[model samples]
Target: MPDRIFDFEKDFAGSLRCIPMAVRLKLDLVGIKLSLRQWSRLDRDQRGRLLEVPCGGAADRHTIGAMIEEWVTATGGTIDRIDPADSANWSNTNTVPEVVVLQAKGEDVSAPSLSQWRALTDQQRFALIKLTRPGHENKNFVPAMREFGLFLAD
Candidate 1:
């Protein structure tokens, strides 16, 4: 299984201080909300395992979800379960969500065309959606776009 952590996240991926986008995507897939405090409780090895595990099917999601809940609770942290259905936006290759477009425009980058959006991997789409949400730091938005080849030449 591939670890989908993005290149932009490499700065803190070693320490696992911040939750990498890959884990965030997995959390969405498994319907578990992992708090940063909870994530901090895990060592680098554990965080690495989370990145390495694949959540490709129903059984995989179940195993990861149970493992996440168990790990968080074992570390005296809580797991908030979210409905992954809300994450459907990333899976839709047809329409590029407005939020993602607007956020890109706000960054002085052009919105990705439908063809460009369709070309992205699900994890890339997930990262873009998460990076574009209101209140997200967004410092990495353009870099992620560039990495994904969704950014146009300036």
Candidate 2:
């Protein structure tokens, strides 16, 4: 599937005001951490290239990795590399994450079932995990769950 900038992110996605989850996932995959402030300093074209660059194979990873390194340097940001773990909560299809469920339950919303969670695309799962993070805005959590058909906000 093509890279996505989800509907909840559309408003800022056009302006790159906030980094899209697709790019965020790619950054995670490549072990780079990009902050929104640093991301905003980049020109629109560069931001667009980041979204367009193929991010699948090892060769593609190298290409985007180099591009991100250049962009980080130009933006006066240092890359804080993180090794993406294969065992992350989002990567686990066997069970739904408790925090996600609790966050939803906090709002009286139902979180996804195991079957539904397992059915989600990695990026979709990533978006949910991100939307539920501590101190990060949880406003989009329900919308995302709805978008993924994992919940119906009543």
Best model per TM-score: 1
Regions of candidate 1 where Cα sits further than 4 Å from its true position: 152-154
Worst 10 residues of 1 by lDDT: 1-10
Candidate 1 per-residue C-alpha lDDT over 1-154 given as tens digits, one digit per residue, 9 for 90 to 100: 3456688778876467889888888888888888888898987788888988888788998998888888888888888978874567988988999989899889988888999999988888888898887776888889889999876557
Query: TM per model?
Result: 0.92, 0.88
| Per-residue alpha-carbon lDDT of candidate 2 for residues 110-152, written as tens digits (9 for 90 to 100) | 8788899999988898888888889876888888888888765
Candidate 1 whole-model C-alpha lDDT, 0 to 1: 0.83
Error of 1 at 52 (Å): 0.5
